[model samples]
Target: MSTTTMKYAVTDSLMMLRRSMLHIARYPSMTLPLIIGPIVFLFLFVYVFGGTLGAGLDGSSGGRADYVNYVTPGILLLTVAGAATATAVSVATDMTQGIVARFRTMSIFRPSLLTGHVLGSVIQTLLSVAVVLGVAVAIGFRPNANPAEWLAAVGILTMLIFAITWVAVIMGLVSDTVETASNLPMLLMLLPFFGSGFVPTDSMPGWLAAIAENQPFTPVMETLRGLLMGTEMGNSPWIAMAWCAGITAAAFAGSVALLNREPGR
Candidate 1:
């Protein structure tokens, strides 16, 4: 694309982004669960399970601090899935609505619509993550990450948000209804629980440990934990990046292909 065309695409994307943002602003119910659910989970884990699970994850010396630190990153990633699920619902609703057909006949850049939804979802996910972090801070959660480490953490999270939002987008595209679209990402939200998110993989049974150690969520949680708590991450950073990159690329390609396909085909 030429400079002018590129500029127009960017402008159009921004406008579409604004539209998506407005939809969020107008519907507080859509955002409320994203903010509240994680906060509830944070409280539940820290207050209820913290004492017992704390012992398992960390010995007496590390105790509660370890649980607080370990759970924070996992909850943060869950917040990302919440935001993506919302976008999936929005995209599914858009696909089912007559307005999409109207837009199809217009001279607008179609890619901007999906781009706008993705950008808007990422922004919302970051905001939700911040809220969860704040809640964690209000409790006893503390991290030793320096400024540079903090920046790297944010970069990792942005990639995660980007990667998952596209998967949500494709789910939205494939589903025939908004309800179906929303369910897929909800299933994704459970990934953290099964991985090394809340606890160490070694404590799990041999077969379960093998699964948890190899999965994408474990790598991501490990990377985040390493960044924040100054733990040794080994190859988790590289593995996490590889997982996110591959998922994002595949999902983006699938979304574009599905979007370009004829409605009745």
Candidate 2:
């Protein structure tokens, strides 16, 4: 917690980050799937089912009821979620390896180890998000935001990814094995569908509609959509940030406590 410790932690985190990135570079298959999975969903939703889904919207779900604009944000959220799953798996694998035990004997910054995996995953997430965004742009899905708006959008996505990283860290630490950690975060990927990612909450049944409107993804998606298309901001930006901050704080605390409770896990 001292300035010296803080300085060392940052240095150690960056070093660990480079190590994680090198792993990804060496394992092209691991890197490819995380980037491709969301791209497939984007194409399928926008092409295969877009017309049918758009017809249901009937032009009431903002001007972006056209499937591409309506669903791009959701796919971006999926990209981050998928990256978080990878993060969890990587962390769990590290826990099982001899390296974690070796590090405990060294004088290196301990938290840096976790930060490395999470930060590395975040860089991957941002890369995947950019690829998705590029694909979205190629297909004529215009967000139409100015530079400032685009920056704001990026800021929100960054915070959201950072929050999800902590959650993945906690999952990785507490998991009994890599398989469990890998599979557990699948729920994060499904959450967008349950919320307002693909469609408007108002269009669903009463019970389903209520759930869709209130979930974390719904507000985040709504905020992103509004910012991109220049719609009403309302309270969505604040609400979305609140969710991100709350999750990040809780998950960071829990992950730290659990890591201390179970060393090398």
Q: Top model by TM-score, which number?
A: 1
Tens-digit lDDT string for candidate 1 (1-265): 9998898789989999999999999998888899999999888888889887888865445566678988899889878877777989999999988567777898777788788999998888888898889889889888989999999999999998999999999988888998898887888888888888788888899999998888778888999989999887999999999999999999989998888788867
Kindly report the root-mean-square deviation of model 1 from the true structure over all alpha carbons. Answer: 1.3
Q: What is the C-alpha lDDT of each candidate?
A: 0.87, 0.85
- Give the alpha carbon lDDT tens digit for every residue of 1-265 in model 2: 8999999999999999999999887877766777799889988888888878877764445333378888999999998888888889888888877677788788888888888988888888898899889988888688889899899999999999999989999888878799999898998998789988887788889999998877778788989988898766689999999999999899988877776565633
Off by over 4 Å in 2: 58-65, 263-265
Clashing pairs in 2: none
